[model samples]
Target: MSLATLWALGSVGDRLRVAYRLLSKDLDMQIETTAVIRNVQKGTASGDLTTHGLEFDQLDPAQQMAMKAFVFDRQDDALEWSHGAR
Candidate 1:
């Protein structure tokens, strides 16, 4: 997410709809979901930017399963890597 996304989302505990586009060599899909802003931290990102953690809510069962599968597929990577585009 960008700085604008952070600003538009407001503070922690806020609920927001996020649009996600997943693309790869053979796959493309878009998902829209609501997420709860779980945490925000200053100095956790580059320069003066802040980082936020979101907990997804009201997910379609397939969406949730796909996300879990994606993360599991990359289980060897750093935990933060899977946060992208979701």
Candidate 2:
């Protein structure tokens, strides 16, 4: 469950919200609405950027991993697989 996978799955918004809540109170991340959208688009188009916020540098390893997992988990449930076993 990587950030790139989440963005590709169109779940960046959810992950961003979670990360914002987890870090906003302790860090300086503001979770800019427009910036989040722009970052998603950029990540999708260029695939060069790893993160989209000023606070990304401040997050610890655990927080980063948690955010990635959150996004992946949400996306995992949203996907539909017709051939998979129920």
- TM-score per prediction, in order, is 0.63, 0.31
Q: Which ten residues in a row have the lowest lDDT in candidate 2?
A: 29-38
Clashing pairs in 2: none
Residue 11 in model 1: lDDT: 76
Q: How far is candidate 1 from the true structure (C-alpha RMSD, Å)?
A: 7.1
Q: Per-residue lDDT for 17-45 in model 1, tens only?
A: 88886544333567798888887766645
List where candidate 2 sits over 4 angstroms from the true fold: 1-19, 22-55, 80-86
Q: What is the C-alpha RMSD of each candidate to the true structure, in Å?
A: 7.1, 11.5
Candidate 2 lDDT over 1-86, as tens digits, reads 12433233333443333234423222433232211322443444554545433224345666566566666655554564433445
Question: What's model 2's TM-score?
Answer: 0.31
Error of 2 at 75 (Å): 1.3
Q: Which predicted model would earn the best lDDT?
A: 1
Best by TM-score: 1
